[model samples]
Target: MGKKNVSGWSTIIMLLTAAALFTGCSASAGSKPSAELHEKTMHWDKMPEMTIDLDKSYTAKFTTSMGDFTVKLYAEDSPITVNNFVFLAKQGFYDGLTFHRIMETFMIQGGDPKGNGTGTPGYSIPDELDTELKYEPGIVAMANTGKPNSGGSQFFISTGKDSENLNQMPNYTIFGKVTEGMDTVLAIAKTPVKETKPIEPVIIEKVVIVQS
Candidate 1:
């Protein structure tokens, strides 16, 4: 009778181990990949282009490690650029990314998944330049590689008086403006940097968009 009891307990323990292993595997398979993993295995070819109404306005609230700031997008003025930004924000593409470029008294630039200036959303969009709209202080605009229609995910927020000069070269697309949190924008601009890159990374926690 004692021998039979031991054998039954051994069988139960083996069954429980197998069940635990299966549960672990299932949980791992169902979990979403981390941002680091996604970056390594990113396939830009599958990224879809979004369409947004031009008549409506969209506001994006950015919660960064430095502070929070709100940007009011100019959809009517830059429909394609605004739509692209909205799509990326909703998809959580900008989360955990850092503002790689910072220019004191100029602007703070970010939106690269690689935490460097060269990353993109697997695609580039055409320029939506409007001569009527100037790059004044607190203005948010897309960062391009000087080539026409080279705007990608990177963008910069104007800081000091020098930003107005950006208007002379109508290459960057003016998409939004910082309606609130100018102080936070200025604080980010003041962060120490080595050349254009920041010494200590200012992480973007998340971006939320509200349609208006």
Candidate 2:
């Protein structure tokens, strides 16, 4: 299926504005005093040791609270990103984490241990961007801070036509694309959010990876 047309430049602009506003709200929440206290109360140093065979194909089956979906990792196009994601999945790093950032007609982001956008995997990985990979809906990619090779465990799934523009900016690492259960993804995307965060937590039950 093709991406839905978002009307025109004006609608696209409005979507972009909403996205920006959501990001800003998330940022502000992370910086709040209560959020700082929450950070201090919780230990964020847990990182798993993992390994991956770069020679094989990997597919991740995500069983989420909303439903199940599968993404096929592009090992050849994004070796490092795929490897890291596979490793994390095997280690159950994504279990119970909430999709914290949800912008309708944009993307749903998660994989942060903190359930906040600011959390990381205690380290960053180098970017593996492929010019050939466009950010179409169902494209799974790493989320970064616009800095070089700063991707961690945080990632997002493209949900709208605007992702085509995201393809133009090659900052985020494109690692995989959802091959099944996109209907579940779209359902999750329609969830209501306040300050870019889902009003109710959408939990990731587990991530199961299979090698081929």
Candidate 3:
């Protein structure tokens, strides 16, 4: 995928660089996040059914090499996006994935099974932007190909600094916000990168969905 800057850019996916072509190893520290790496070839022919109860609150606990963070999903505001995210989390689709694109001031993006920006879950979902969502720090949203209804498996978290710039590009669908571990999110944002890809891999060990 191609990449573009914040100014005069139409799509966030366009900011993808050649660094996405290579997968880096996690920095030396703790044990692997999972016992086995999740399969990458897993694909769906269509969007998942809405199985989650909208009356209940949903949160996703993300365990990564940098640390852990919890995102409260907006099921009522963005049901389709939340449903797909929860479905993938339950299916272990985000295990052993890397944050392929990390811009310190912009956002950190991952959930691409291919460890690159071009991979997807063999499906797509429509954009859900009718809420009072903003691209502020800790807000999580879906990344797309700058086309309507083009979002799939890739997602991003607003780190800080340049997050406000994202407001100008409102096509990405907002699904959740970080309720805990903002420090971890900020730390992950600072991971050394060559261009936009992390020089040392920041692995997303797993993503667990919790409901109440």
Candidate 4:
């Protein structure tokens, strides 16, 4: 009787082990691919040809390591900036890029190909600033070198409501705003950082453009 009991317990243990292995394999197969698997970064000789229809409304959905956020593009108000952004988003230029700068309670900046403060898309676009737009929280704007017509691929999203400081320096082009998932943007803003850079990488996994 004792021998039979021992044999039954051994069978139970083997079945449990097999189940665990199968679960592990399934999870591994279904998981999203790591950022390293994507090779979408490339330099363009000039700005991409404008293909966005001004009449249609557009939005960009960014999938990141922390979470997802959606930005509504102000195409009519900032056509050039919106067009360039849309082109890059469709081309997958922003994928796998890290959010290099983070100013707590202020903003989070990304879209730099170099994953640092000094990368551009091999070209620059003229600033498309509107006097009416305010640099309030959830506002998305282009990052530039504090020079005229120096706007490029880098962009930032405002996380704080206090814009008296940004309003004073009114250079970042206001092309979009976070229409959904501001929580994700704030979450990223709260990431631990050193020297204004996130200690651990917060990658832009992908950016999907939606036109209506």
Which predicted model would earn the best lDDT?
3
Q: Write the per-residue lDDT of candidate 1 for residues 1-212, one digit (tens) a residue.
A: 01232356655643432221111112221244445422322425433565676666789999999999999998888888898899888888888888777777667888865554556676678888754787788998887655677666778888886665454445678999999999999999899888767788898899999986
Could you give the candidate ranking by TM-score, starting with the highest? 3, 2, 4, 1
TM-score of each: 0.78, 0.80, 0.82, 0.79
Model 3: how far residue 153 lies from native, Å: 0.8
Report per-prediction Cα RMSD to one decimal. 22.3, 5.3, 7.6, 20.8
Best by TM-score: 3
Q: Model 4, range 1-212, lDDT digits (tens) per residue?
A: 01232356655643432221111111221234345332335778788778899989999999999999999999988999999999988888998887878876677888877664556677788887754787889988887765678777888888874433456446678898999999999999899999777888899999999999
Candidate 2: worst 10 consecutive residues by lDDT?
36-45
**Model 3, range 1-212, lDDT digits (tens) per residue?**
12335543434433342122222233222222243333386788898998999999999999998899999999999999999999999999998888988988778889877665666777789989877777889999888766678788889888875666556546678999999999999999899899787898899999999999
Query: Candidate 1 vs candidate 2: which has greater TM-score?
Result: 2
TM-score of 2: 0.80
Candidate 1: worst-modelled 10 consecutive residues by lDDT? 20-29
Q: What are the per-residue Cα lDDT tens digits for candidate 2 across 1-212?
A: 23455558856665463343222123532354434222322323433343667777899999999999999999888887887888777767888787878887878888866675666666678877745887889998888766677677888898888666664345678899999999999999999899777888888889999998
- What's the lDDT of the predicted structure labeled candidate 1? 0.72
lDDT of each: 0.72, 0.74, 0.79, 0.75
